[model samples]
Target chain A: MNLIISTLRKDDLYNKKIIENIQKNISNVEIIYTEDMNIKGCIGCNRCWLVTPGICTIKDDYEKLLIKFLQSKQVVFITDLKLGFVSYKLKNIFDRILPLLTMNLRFKNGQMRHYFRYKKHYKMGLIYKGNGNREFLEKWLERVMINLDGTSIGTYNIENEEEILNALINC
Target chain B: MHLLIVSCTPRAKEKSNTDKILDELRKGYEYNGNTTETLYLYKRNEWESIREKFYENDNILFALPLYVECIPGIMAEFLETLKPKQNCNTKIGFLLQSGFAEASQLRCCESYLETLPSLLGCEYNGTLLKGNMFAVSFLGSKMGKQMVEPFYNMGKYYAQNNYFNKEVVNDFAKPEYFSKKEIFLSNVVSPLNKLFMKVFAKKLGCKGSLNDKPYQNYIKR
Candidate 1:
């Protein structure tokens, strides 16, 4: 399954474009439009890692999305550039996904990382607009994927719709 | 000038590691005759007031826990509300701590934190990166308090100078990577630690298995 999350507005043309392209070119896609959802940011509660284990205590709209994420083999974060990084909407989703990982520390690739709670090999991709401070962001994305034990498929500027489709299709 | 210490930890005040670090720093800052106000961002209703205080102060320090290899999601949202100020003399620095022992786990986030002050039109005060925060459960223990006691000295240095002491920052972010021998030991201990987490969760009265896969069947792999 390919899970594509967009922080774009429900009425935005780019949001529709990305989903339409994914639907046409990809199979078994789960599309999440952030503006249409009401999810709060993670409060740094340790309940997900301790009490419930692989479940967040916040009890918001994110649980349905989290379940979808576990089933996904690939995820593409569709967002706008904000302060040289992904938008807060996309960032909130990333933070809330902490339940997917355990609190235990392990060394992988010479870095300390949380062990996976579930056994799944997932890949991540990014689609964003603008080029403000992209060098750091690209590196950051690679680092985030490394923590997930996944490889980043890379980023696509808004104009490179074909490149994105090709990457997903080939992924 | 007064300092405004902002805590980006979304955990409750009693359970926050960042809050404890800030307490030590504030003690040093106040002892040096510099007054300070510490703000916690977890109080969603107080953001409007927090933003006002942030704008009013010139020396600001954001102390945050490293989550998901970056700033916490709530911190990101709060940052989004801040607009770039022009001709502002506010200087910003960071106290970035991680539970992980290696500096490599925090390098990317540190890079991002370094770029933050400049992007907001504030002077870039250097970030103090440290690892080995370990766990919140142990932070309340006597041994844990001893571990963070050294940050008091950092607070004293900040009171005299606006930024973190460079020598201390270097020392704190130690063992950036590991020796080849340590890597071998890490490989040996990784599985053991995984088992430890399961045991710890059970002791905490966890209602379900630590490795339960409640949503695994959503897609056929």
Candidate 2:
């Protein structure tokens, strides 16, 4: 199974086109429109690591989504760039996933980062829609991959439905 | 020059390391006969007024901790509220501090912050990145006092020159990349530290289940 978490607005034309293409090409995929979800930003309380021990203390829609994340073989993010980075809505989702990683630090690629709690390795991709700097996004994604213990298959700038479809199919 | 310092931490002013550093910086700015104000970004109700202050100020500095290799979610949300540049001549700077001992952990977010000035139509005044900053909270202790002096000096230099001294910034962000010797030492010490932490957590009734998958039961698709 694959999970697609999108921060695009309901009426966005690009979102519509991308969703249509994914529906036609992909199977056993779950699409989450993040704006419609009841998710809260992480408060950085350290409860997930210290108190609850790999459980987010905040009760919200994120719990269900996190479970789906672990079960899925692949996860993709479709977001609009804000200041050459992920939008606040998408970043909020990313921040709330700290429980997916253990508090233990390990060295990977010559940098220290938290170890992943899950055994499965998921392929990740970013499909961004904006005129933001691509180099900055690529570097940020590279760091993200290292931390999450995921492989970055591709990062695509929205041009057309075919481009989006190809990226999804390849992933 | 009117300076607006935004301390972006989820914790309250008294408990935040970033706020403590900004406080010292504010002292330097005030010492130079400059007016300064601080806004704690977690005060969500005051965001509108803070935005107005942001527009009214000439120099804006963001002091924040690095979270998950980036700025905190609240900071990102605050950045979203800013309207695109409209004759705004604000000079923007950042003070990014992290708990990680290696300075390299904070470099990726530094690049992201550099791009923010362009998005806001402000001049980039450079960023100050510091690592192993968990000690800033113990300001009364000797180690804490030593850790904070560099920030105080950087703040004073900025107040006098209207920009961070490149030498001071570079010195403060020492060992930009950790050496092999440091890496080896960390690798040797990390496991022992983890073992100690596990024992401590167990004593706190948390047990050694720090790596437990609590959501295993919720995996039904």
TM-scores of chain A across candidates: 0.92, 0.92
Error of 2 at B23 (Å): 2.6
DockQ of 1: 0.66
Task: Give one digit per residue, the lDDT tens place, for model 1 in A28-85.
Answer: 8888887778888887767788888877888779998887766778888888887777
Individual DockQ of the candidates? 0.66, 0.57
Tell me the lDDT of candidate 1.
0.81
Q: Write the per-residue lDDT of candidate 1 for residues B1-221, one digit (tens) a residue.
A: 58898999888888887777777778877885789888889888999999998888889999999887788878888988998878989999899888888776788888888888888889888888778876644545676677777788888878787787667787767888888899788788878876777787788788787766666676444
Please give the range of 10 consecutive residues that has the lowest summed lDDT in model 1 chain A.
Answer: A129-138
Q: Each prediction's Cα lDDT score?
A: 0.81, 0.80
Query: Across residues B17-68, which tens digit of lDDT does each residue of candidate 2 receive?
Result: 7877787778877876788888988899999998888877779998889887
* Fold similarity of candidate 1's chain A to the true chain A, as a TM-score: 0.92
The TM-score of predicted model 2 comes to 0.92
Q: Give the clashing pairs for model 1.
A: none
